[model samples]
Target chain A: MKTKERSSENKICPLEVAVNSISGKWKVPIVWQINEGKKRPSEFLRGIAKVDRRVLNQQLKEMEQDGILTKVSFNELPPRVEYSLTELGEKLVTILWMLNDWGKLMIPAEED
Target chain B: MKTKERSSENKICPLEVAVNSISGKWKVPIVWQINEGKKRPSEFLRGIAKVDRRVLNQQLKEMEQDGILTKVSFNELPPRVEYSLTELGEKLVTILWMLNDWGKLMIPAEED
Candidate 1:
């Protein structure tokens, strides 16, 4: 019984970890924007309304550290930077698509 | 261009709504417990650590309103109550399973 209980707890951990990893207010939006091919910080600022630079940068850095994003800085006069989804990040996008479909189910409930 | 942008915005809305609905700290854990056949409130409190009665009740009420759960009350000596997943909630479990798989990908990153 103890072993079974521990196994159940272990099963629960990944879902909690997954939710926590993407639980940041701007994290999912940032990932969605990148998946849509908007690569730069400036584009994200424009695409997602009301997210200031500092918070956006913090979320971006966290996602990068989490291996969901790869940040590339180009040496230039203006010092250009771009972010793209890594393999793990791409996998997350596929799951988000499933979530998006599931979310559609709740829209009618939300409207009512 | 404006119409296209509007379409894109609509696409984003459902995922945001979905995230908001389940974003409650104890919501997913509560759902997991129910899905595991632990139906009573007391069972959830014991299974999930650190959740107080008030917060648990609030999350349960919100989920019931959102159509993710159905609450039943039995009239008896002490009034038994139980919660179970609605069809929408079961659908969400399917998506969460996918999310759980995606989360496993990040475990290696998290370990390092």
Candidate 2:
């Protein structure tokens, strides 16, 4: 829908749409770690950044749906899966960096 | 929190953080309407975009809390309230536009 129509119908703002695209709870850190060169599912599970398997899988699936990343599975013993970003997904990191900068400036009101 | 520490602690991703900053459900639309020159709260409530007062008020309060918008109230008959972006809030719109562009491309899987 056009922006005008979208607003007219949904009443949920543009910011919410932006939020919905990546609001899977675990999507962000997964994307960040992937960008930082953690390519394998196991690597993502390990490391200092640890997302619960169920949520991680859900976010990974959603990211693939968003076309932000692609998931490729290998037909090997025990099976292996790898997730990587599409060009569009990679482009989002630059914008995300700006958001990160904003977050840093806005002091968290409470310790989370 | 530092991105690394944030990940270690929350396990939610940076993409989620990006989403959280504006995830109030009604925030983006309100911001979009404001940038389109709907400065008055009533005008925002009106227009083709119809947001429920409770959700709008909640989103507005949250935006003010986020430093994305400042709420100016005039203590007069019927009380006048105006919401406008801070310098940082203004800066966020350009990035929001990028998010809008991405949404346009991501065909909604289902009609809402």
Q: Can you tell me which runs of candidate 2 are displaced by over 4 Å?
A: A1-18, A47-50, A108-112, B1-18, B47-50, B108-112
State the DockQ, from 0 to 1, for candidate 2: 0.28
lDDT digits (tens) for residues B12-67 of candidate 2? 44334446868766677788888998888788888535578887888888888778
Assess every candidate by TM-score. 0.87, 0.76
Worst 10 residues of 2 chain A by lDDT: A9-18
lDDT of 1 by residue, B1-112 (tens): 6856745565548889889899999999999999899999999999999999999999999999999999999998798999999999999899888888887877764331
Candidate 1: C-alpha lDDT: 0.90
How many backbone clashes are present in model 2?
9
Model 1 misplaced stretches (Cα beyond 4 Å): A1-12, A109-112, B1-12, B109-112
Clashes in model 2: which pairs? A13-B29, A14-B28, A14-B29, A15-B28, A28-B13, A28-B14, A28-B15, A29-B13, A29-B14
lDDT of 1 at B68: 97
| Candidate of highest DockQ | 1
